[model samples]
Target: MSTKKHKVLVANRGEIAIRIIQACVSLGLDFVCVYTRADEASGHLALARSLGGPNAAYRVSSYHDANEILAVADHAGATAVHPGYGFFAEDFRFARRVAERERSLIFIGPSWRIIRSLGDKINTKRLARSLSIPTVPGSDRPVYDELEAEEIAETLFAFQAEQGISNSVVLVKASAGGGGMGIEEIYDIEQFKTVYRRIRNYAKRQFHDEGVLIEQRIFDFNHLEVQIVADRTGTGIVHFGTRNCTIQSTGRQKRVEIAPGFRPQEVDYAFDAEKLMEDIVGYSLAMAREVGYDNVGTWEWIVSPTGQPFLMEVNTRIQVENGVSAAISRVRGQGGVNIIAEQIRLGLGEPMGYDQSNITFDGVGIEYRIIAEDPANRFTPWVGRIDQFLAPTLPYASLHTHIPMDEPYEIPTEYDPNLALAIVWGKDLAEAKKRGVDYLDELTLSGADGTGTELKSNVRFLRDKTSTILQF
Candidate 1:
C-alpha cells in the first residue's frame, strides 16, 4: 500500500493491460498505457482514460518497440514498467535497459539478473539439475559440437528405451529460440544427425546462436505449473498451489486451466496427486531460492502417465492463468488474491508481510481462454468485427477481458484473437466443472470476417473439454 507515489507504464495491450490498470487502481498507483493504431478500440485505453490521469493513454507506433514505451514512461513521469505477460515481460534485456537507463524505471517482475539467468532453457536445465531437481534427461547446456549433440540424442533415446517407451523420440530445439520454434522431433536414431544439422543451421540463421538442445521428447503428458511469489529480498518465497494445464490445442497451447493440479478425489490417478503437488512446489521454491528469484514466476512441469514429474521451464512473469490460481487461493482465510497487483507491489520493493503459513487453498478454480477462433480447424483465428459479446455475471465467476460488452468491437488481426478469459470457482471439481459448462452455455459471442461468414469461437471446444478437465 506504499506505491502512491509510483506510476506504472503498462507495456502490453488487451485483457492483460486492462487487468494491470485495474491492479494499479486497486493499489492506489498512477498508471499510463500505450497502444498501436491497430488496437485503437481496445478497452484498456478507455479504462486508462477513465481511471488514470489526463495523459493515461498514449499512442505509440508499436508495443514491441522498447524505446517507444520508455519514451512514453518518461513523458508521463512513470516510475515503473509493468510488462503484462507478453511483449517485454520476459525480455531480460528490456528489463535491464529499463533499470539501467538514465531515467531508470522499475521493471515490475523479477530482477533483470534473475530473468536473464532463467530465460535460457539450457541454463534453466543446468540450474535445476544442480539443485537435484527432476528435469528431462538432456544436455544441460547448448551442444555446439555436432558429435556431442549426437551423443546426447543417443543417450536420450536409450533412456526412453530403458523406460519401456516403444517409440523412442528425441527433440532437437535451438537453445535460444522459444515459443516452439526452431524445434523438431526424430523417431529414429539414424535420422538424429540429419535433424541436428538442420536445426543447428536454422538456429544460427534465426537467432545467431548455433547452440542446440537435444532432449527426450515427452508425449502424452499432463502439463502442470507451480506459481511462486517472493519479495525483492528473495527469501519470502511461497506457492499458489498447482493447476492442471493438460487440455490444450492441437498445437499444444493451453485453453482450459484448473487449479489444484490433480483431483485425486474425482479420478483414480496412478500418482499421489497431493504429494506430487507438494514435491513440485518444494522443488520450485528451492530453485527460486537458488537463483534468488525475486518476484512472481511459474515453474512449468510435465507429468507423465505414471505421474513422474519433470521441470519444463520457468516463466519469469505473471501468466494468463494466474487469476485462476488466485481464484482458488486465500490469504489468511480471506479470498481476494490478486497476483498481478502482488507482482507490482513486490517489484516496487514492497514487503511480503505474510508467509506460506498464512496462505491456504480452498475450492477448485477453472479458467477458459475465450478466443475468436475455430478449435476444430487447428485453432485457426476468426478475424472480424464482433457484433455481440455477452459475458454472464455470476457470484462464482469472474471475467477478465478487453472486449467491450456494450458495443460492437473489431477483432484485431495484428495480435492473437484472444478475446477474454472466463474464470469460475466452486467447492470441488464437480461443481467447478458444472459452473464452467453453464458459463459457456449462457455466454453469447458472435462476429464475422470479410467473407461475411458466421463467427467461429472456441466456446464449443471449451464446453466439450469441461467433462474431462481434471480427470487423470
Candidate 2:
C-alpha cells in the first residue's frame, strides 16, 4: 500500500512509456524505462532519463524478452512493471511472471487470472451470455468440426436474413487468432465452407490451433469501448465513460477515438444514443465487478446499425485510447484527469477514495492517432526520417509523441511509426470537431523516407473522419 517506495519499470516504449513515467512522477514514485537500440532516439527514454535521475533508462535487446525485462527491473530496483499497451500488455503469462517470480514485481494491470479469463474471446462471450449481457450473434466456442461449423454458419446467415439485414455476411476467423489475423469474410453460404477450411488451415499452420470462430458480421456497426477503473480490492468500480472507435484503418487498426461514444444532441442516430451509452457502461461495470477486475481495463463493444450493443472482448490492460476518456472526465468538480496516473496509483494497491458520484464529465474530447502511414494504400507503414514535427499551440489541444521536435528523427522501421496522439476537447461536439480540424491543419508534420519519398500520413484521413464521427 506504500506507493512511495515503489519504483516502476516501464516494460514498453514510445509515447506510452513517457505516459507511464509521467504517471509515476505524478504519483510521487521513482520509475525506470527500457528501450532497444532502434528506440534510442525515442522521447520516452529522454524523458525518463531527465526525470528519473541516474540510470532511469535501460537498453534491452528486445522489448518482448521477459528475461531481459526482468533483469532490467532487478538492476533498476523496480517494484512494479507497467506494460503500457502492446508488447506484453495483454499477455497473462507475462503478468503472472511479474507477480509469481521469486522477487515479484507488481503488474500494473488487472490480475493475471483476470487477464487469462477475459483474454479468450470465446470465454468472454460465454461469461457475458451467462450474465445475460448481449454478445454478437455467433458461435461462442471454436467450430472445430466441419459439419458443426457449416451448421453454425447457415444458422447465422438465416438469423441475419430474418433481421432484414441486406447483403448478409458471415465472418469465419481463427478463434485463437488476434490482431486481425487469420480471418476472412464470406458472403455466400456455399463459399462459407471453403473460407472456413482455409482459415482453419491457416490457424493450424500459424497458431497451431485449428479452432475457428463463426459469427454474423454486422455491417455499419460502430466500434465502441467502455473504460473501467477499479481499486486494488476490486470492490470499487467506476467508469470514465465510453469511446467511439469506429474510425479505423482498413486493417482494423484504430486511427481516431472520441469519448462519450455518441452525441445524440448534435447528430441523429437510429437508436437512443444516451441509453445505449448507459447500457454499455453498466454492462462493462457489471462484468468488471463480476471478475473482480482490480485495475484499469477496457470493455470493447460493437453496436449494430439497428442499435444493438454487443460485447466484443475485454482488454485487461490500459489502452492507448484511455487518454481520450480522461481528457473529458472530471472528478470532484476538478478537471485535468490523468487516467494513467490513476491506473498506476490503483495498480499499486491504492484505495478508491472517491465514489462514482464524485466523478463528472465535462466537454467532448477527440483523440487522433497521427501515424506515418499511407492510409490510401491500406495503411501501409511509412518509414523514413521526420524532419519537422510541429504541434499546435492550442489550450484545448494536447499532443503526445516520441519523435523529438527540435531535431530530425528517423522513423525506426523496427517499430510502428505512430508519430503522436492529438487530443482536442471542446464545450460541445461541434466545437470539438472544429478544434480537431484546426489542430490538424496547424500541425506541421513533414518527413521523408530513405528514397526521399514524402511522408504519407493519416492526417487528411483523420481530418475527414472528424466531420462524420458518431453519426452512425
Candidate 3:
C-alpha cells in the first residue's frame, strides 16, 4: 500500500459519480471521470469541469467497458479507480484486471480474491453455513439445467410436506446478480422447469451467468441490512442500526428508513432488538474476517414472521441508501465517517480510523429514491429534458443528484431509471417521515411546456402519507 496521495478514476456515472468527485475534493486528491457519449453535457461532467485542476474527464462508448476505462486511467496517470455502486462495482474480473495492471493501479473496493469468493450467491450461502450463520433453506449447489432445478424443487416440496406446511414459495435467483435483477418467483412445484429456464436465460443475458440458486421465499417478512466498514488489519465496525426496506412491491426498493420502528400493533413478530443487532453484527464481522473483506460492504437479511433472521446476500460495494447511514452517524456525534475516504485509505494500507465503540446511532434517518418513471403506468421509463428543477432546502436533509439548473435541463439518454435521492434525519421515525414528505413535496421536475412530454417522476408517490408506513 502506498502512502502517497492518489489520483482516482471514477468509472461510473450519475449521482454516485458526483458523490465520489466531492469526496475526492474533500480529501485533496486528484480524480478523473469517464462518461458515455450520451452524457457529454451531463451535469456530472459539468461539475468535474467546474472543479478543474489535475482532474480529467473522458468519454467512452459504455461504462461497463473495463478495458476502455483502464486505458483512460492509464493515459490520465490515475493511481486508483472507484467503481461507484452499480456497473462494475462488484465485478471481480474488473478488480483482478486493476490488480494485475503493470502500472499498479488500486481498485478501491475489496480484493479480487474476496470478490470472486463471495460474488456468487450459492457460494456465499455455503460460506455462511460453514461459519454457523443461519441461512434460508435452499439448494446448496448451483442449478445449471432444468433437471437440477426440478430436483431442487421436489426436494423443497418434500421437505415442506414433511413439516406439514403449505404456501411454500421458492425463488430462482441468478448466482451472479445484484440490484434485485435476475430473480423469478415459483409458487408451484410444477412450474419449476419453465420458470427455471426463463430465469437462467435472463441471468445469462443480463449477468453473463447461467448458474442459478434456489431459496425458500419467506412471505410477510421484513428486509433488513447492516452496514459494515473494515480495513486490511481486520479492524471493523458494524453500524448496528438497521434499516427497514420492506415497503417494496416488486422486490425493488422504493423507500428506506433507518432504525425501523416496529409497532407491536402492526406485526406479530417478537424479538429482542438489542440481541438481534448484536448477533447480526457479530455474524457480519465473522464472515468479513473469513473472506478477508476490506472497505465498505453490507450484509442483507430477510427476517421471517417468526423472528428468524436468515442471510440473504452480501453487497461488496457502497449501497444506494448510504446517505441514511451517514446521516444517522453524523447526528449521533460520530463525525459521520466518510465511507469513500475509508475505502481509499484501506486500499492504501491504512488501519480503520475508528473502532466499534466509535459507532453510535442517535436518530432516525430515511431515504427515498426518486426515479424517472411513471408509477401509474407500470413504472415505465420516463425520459425528457427538464425545464425547471427545484429541490427543497432543509437542515439535516441531503440531496444527491446531478440535475442542473439552466435554461434547458436535459437528462442523459444512456442511464438508469434513477433521477435523485433525498435523505433526511430526524429525532425519531415519525419526525423523519414528516421531514421526508415535506422534502418530497418541495421537489419539482417538469419538462418544457407544450412539448408533448411523456416524462414523469415518483415525487408525488413519495409524498403520499401512505409511503411512510412500512408495508409487507
RMSD after CA superposition, every candidate: 2.2, 1.9, 2.7
Q: What is the lDDT of residue 288 in candidate 3?
A: 87
lDDT of 1 by residue, 191-310 (tens): 988898999999999789999998888888899999999999989889999988988887677899999898888778887888888889999999999998899999999888778899
Q: What is candidate 2's local distance difference test score?
A: 0.91
Sort every candidate by TM-score, greatest first.
Answer: 2, 1, 3
Off by over 4 Å in 1: 143-151, 177-183, 189-212
Instruction: Rate residue 76 of model 3 by lDDT.
Output: 92
TM-score of each: 0.94, 0.95, 0.92
Better of 2 and 3 by TM-score: 2
Instruction: Return the candidate ranking by lDDT, descending.
Output: 2, 1, 3
Q: In model 3, which runs have C-alpha deviations exceeding 4 angstroms?
A: 1-4, 53-55, 236-240, 249-251, 257-269, 330-334, 448-454, 465-472
For model 1 the local lDDT of residue 339 reads 96
Indicate whether candidate 1 or candidate 3 has the larger TM-score.
Answer: 1
Worst 10 residues of 2 by lDDT: 175-184
What ranges in model 2 sit over 4 Å off?
A: 143-148, 176-182, 197-210
Residue pairs clashing, model 1 = none
